[model samples]
Target: ANTAVKVSIDPAQDGPVINRHIFGQFAEHLGRGVYEGVWVGPDSTIPNTRGIRKDVVGALKALKVPNVRWPGGCFADEYHWRDGIGKPEDRRSRINASWAGRPEPNSFGTHEFFDFIQQIGADAFISANVGSGTVQEAADWLEYLTAQDSSLAKERAANGHPKPYEVAFWGIGNEVWGCGGPFTAEEYVTKLKQFSNFSTNHNKNMPTQQVAVGPDGDGFPEYAEVVMNAWSKRTWAWNIEALSLHRYTRNGWPPNIPATGFNQKQYASVIKETLGMNDFIKTNIAIMDKYDPEKKVGILVDEWGTWYAPTKGTDPGYLEQENSQRDAIIAALNFNIFARHADRVRGANIAQMINVLQAMILTDKEKMVLTPTYHAFRMYVPFQNAVRLKTNYDQGVYKEGDINLPKIDVISARDNQGRIWVAVTNIDPKQSIDVDLSLLGKSIASADGEILKAPTIDAVNSFAKPDVVSPKNLSLKAINGQLKFTIAPQSVSVISVKSQ
Candidate 1:
């Protein structure tokens, strides 16, 4: 038997205020994502700009990757900011490179990263090393970025740019519960408080926006709650601006370990994790409301995306997984979650921006290609400064025997330009869903859509021949007082309607 679902989007009603920060990117000192991806070293001959890749910079800007987080994931914990500065030849060398145990040269440290973000025109969110790093270290790092005039500011000018990056966002520590030290809530909070105390406007008296590592939901419920609770009690020391959570998608599918070659089962597993995000946000936000009813602290899902095992023989530290049609599905779904919960979920960064988990762009030596996830972000970029329209999903469901998952087939946005755009994703890999839009406030003029459907989930594009799987404009029809369309299964569809 087949079931029907209807998603009634009320474009007139204001849903959630979409924060541009919600659509952010992450850059870790891992794999080819940084070393070979963004920064190929100013000295390299691959066509770069001050150790940063000009092509990568152009691509990220075009995609409007609002904010880019730097330093590390777990690597941030061990990162020594001081070593990254000074002369590149004089920079320190270390083995805490990444999960792959590669050599982490601080060649592309603070100044290099800030320049990259600035050139790309995206806000820089720096995640400082707090594990092996000290409070003085964290504080000084903040000053180095924002402080205007000091021996520290002079050092920055000496390094390169005199005008400070003035970065407002700073993450205390990464996964302190896991690779980051597994510190008790009390301990982490104390450490966080201690770090925040000096790190405040100290270096050059730069204003800072502090983000403390919350208890991550690595199966721990109070992970974020504990961090929030501790922050609530602290004195004028900790200026907690955001609480972060990190979650990665894991699918038990072969050859799909490094995120390549995903079957139906693997796709479903990954889909389940992505779909579960709706509830995850609600639950996590409720916990935040426990200690913070006013929702003062911005809920930051700093690291999120599908994470299978690493690709065989590839750079393991790079976290470079194959992004396919299925991965694009995950991106659209997760983005919908962020849009739906834009209130508490102020900002979110996919695992690792380039060549990382569900990343948008993949680079190889002198060549690079855009991923499906990248397209999805670019497609949904129209919703950036727009107000989300309330969507009432149809009473329809897609189920497989005992498994029935609700379809988020309809998400609408009203841009500042007064254009009404609705993005829909069909989870059914085979059955296309019929959507009827009646409550969208008299949109009887004309309609056009874009469809991103591929032959299989694992399909990808290469630099040798890109554009293997891209979203193409779709035709639409308007009838009666309602607009009607068919969304392809396992595909992402976006439709825009014209009406006064």
Candidate 2:
């Protein structure tokens, strides 16, 4: 048996609130992410609520998704909101130049997006076009969505809904350093100021916070420096509340990593690569702190998750990739990292919610299967809006070739109702780790939750076999004032404790 890892949690210490937005979801027009993966026509045989898939909505509702960033990653830059606002048949058809030159019918537009989120009880985070759109266009779009009684609001009313939609957050652009635009940091900042100045949330009661595009990832620190530096010097009229960052985990791009059917070496490599998220968050937050010392301007990791080679015979532009146990580990590691920095790492949205990279759900016609990443998200739902508890643990090393990862990753938090929760990830693929947990200032009366694990690192849930990677019940007993439990190898376990 391996030596036991010690975990100590101080529930009395004040820590940052794990913002519910950190558990946000992303839906883009790329591939079937917004199409068949989410919106199947109301007339289709699939179970749906007004064109939105009922099963997808039902699944996401269980996770209590706080927000959904929509319209695009790169697609947002080229999208013209006007093209999607009117009658369905009158809506214009355009080619998605950023993604495989596929025909975009504009079927699932602004109205449809809000309807889907409403059904699932999520706030809207709309990404406005900046790469190929003008300031006037963006301002008008905002008015159309939030204005109480403007001409655009009337137009919106004529289209369908009589009430203005509540947009909680607005993203100015996507990856301006790359697909959003090849613009240099300086140029993008200039555009950001202009768009931010005109983009007004007409409904004063439901003010929308504006987010400017920041660096793509650690590869380009200059983007953050330039954007944050510009923000620091900005006047009251042109300020942004947050900056957006986009990063994905993969060995390298051209995405050679296969989503499934991989060796243990590849699994370790992926785990090691994903562990870099903590460093990425720290490095970017450091840059932000240099400019905004008070940390008022939050950092939203709007795009993150594992990206792999497209499934064989699938459209490469669609970014279709299978999800597995390795992806689940990646998700849990990222969640823990975000929680540790909850003060400034305000929110995050996984790359693509469905039928895309690191998706939570995958669909084939009418059949839907939850991915292992989905299970991870479901298990950690208790951490949403929960105050972080200072947790210290000794994580031993798991070595594979030159790759070294902490065998165990753990985080603890106290929810609003005073229930303490601990999320543990056993990164080792070959051995379970026994945890000797000590609640420093609390006595556990009961502990129970769920555990997600698979027999193999590459294990996945196919349409025919949906329960292969599903979560199972986990119960822990406190013996002599210490909570003891063994975490399965390559598994994620979330335990909720009620203390006396």
TM-scores, in order shown? 0.93, 0.98
lDDT of 1 by residue, 1-500 (tens): 23356667676688767878777988888877788889898788888988888888888887787888887788888888887888988998898645678888888888888788888888878887777788888878777777778888888899887887767578888887766767877778778878877875543333556888865545656667778888778787567888887766764333245476656765666687677777777888888898899988888888888786766677655566777888888888888888888878888888778877777889888898998888888888887877899888763566655567655466888888988888888887767777777655574677878988887777787787589789898878777756777767789987777774
lDDT of all the models against the reference? 0.78, 0.90
Best by lDDT: 2
Q: Can you list the residue pairs that collide in candidate 2?
A: none
TM-score of 1: 0.93
lDDT of 2 at 143: 93
Model 1, C-alpha of 96: deviation from truth (Å)? 2.5
**Which is the leading candidate under TM-score?**
2
Clashing pairs in 1: 6-394, 31-317, 31-318, 42-51, 139-199, 201-205, 215-223, 449-474
Candidate 2 ranges beyond 4 A from true positions: none
lDDT of 2 at 20: 90
Error of 1 at 126 (Å): 0.6
**What would the C-alpha RMSD of candidate 1 be, to one decimal place?**
2.5
